[model samples]
Target: MDAPSGIISAIVTGLVIGVLGRLVVPGRQAIGCLMTILVGLIGAAGGLAIANAIDAAWLLTLLLQIGVAAVLVLITASATGRNQ
Candidate 1:
């Protein structure tokens, strides 16, 4: 199914947010571009869940998109010492 313009834009934004978020935490991701995009999408969804639980404001989704994902990457990297 084809996505609407808004959905497409959101996907692009999420992809960009994911790349930046990963970069925030030091590591060699060694993943493909597609994987990076996938990670970003997953991170955004996870962030949204946490944000919703914490009652983050509506306007901050994009920033929270990056922040939450970055925090997630940081936590995971610190814990595993490697991405699995």
Candidate 2:
């Protein structure tokens, strides 16, 4: 993908990853849509950075991404005082 396409792909992937992360966390989180997207984007970016450092396989990389996203969601929820 080119630059714009790559960015769009990242946003889309981030949205999905963020939603999946929220789902993984078993509780009602008070985060909004935009916040969710932002969290997901950050999580995905963080996860990819770590994955690059580790040079893991695709499956493990994916799991790590999702796991990282979940952690971010949890943190966001806690920070927002919505995780209870």
Candidate 3:
């Protein structure tokens, strides 16, 4: 894909991954949508980096991204004391 489309795809994928991460966690978090998106974006990039370094499969990479997102969400929620 072209640069713009690639970026767009990343954003979309990041959003989905972020939502999936949130869903995996139990209880309601007080974080906003924007914060969630940011977490997803960071998770996606970080997970992808590690996955790529290890030559992980596409599915594994996606799962890793979601996992990372979940961890990030948990960290943020705890740090902000949004949900205890």
Off by over 4 Å in 3: 1-4
The CA lDDT of each predicted structure is 0.71, 0.87, 0.89
Looking at model 2, the pairs that clash are none
- Taking all chains together, each candidate's TM-score versus the true structure is 0.63, 0.88, 0.88
Per-residue lDDT tens digits for candidate 1, residues 1-84, read 457987887678668877888878676655556656666777788778867878888657666777777875666555655664
Q: Which of the two, 2 or 3, has more lDDT?
A: 3
Which of the predicted structures, 1 or 3, would earn the higher TM-score when compared with the native?
A: 3
* Superposed model 2: Cα runs more than 4 Å off: none
- Summing lDDT over every window of 10 consecutive residues in candidate 1, give the lowest-scoring window: 75-84
Q: State the weakest 10-residue window (summed lDDT) of model 3.
A: 10-19
Q: In angstroms, give how far residue 3 of model 3 lies from its true place.
A: 4.9
Model 2 agreement with the true structure over 1-84: per-residue lDDT tens digits: 689999899789989989988999998898989988888898888888888899988887777788899999999999989776
Cα RMSD, model 2: 1.4
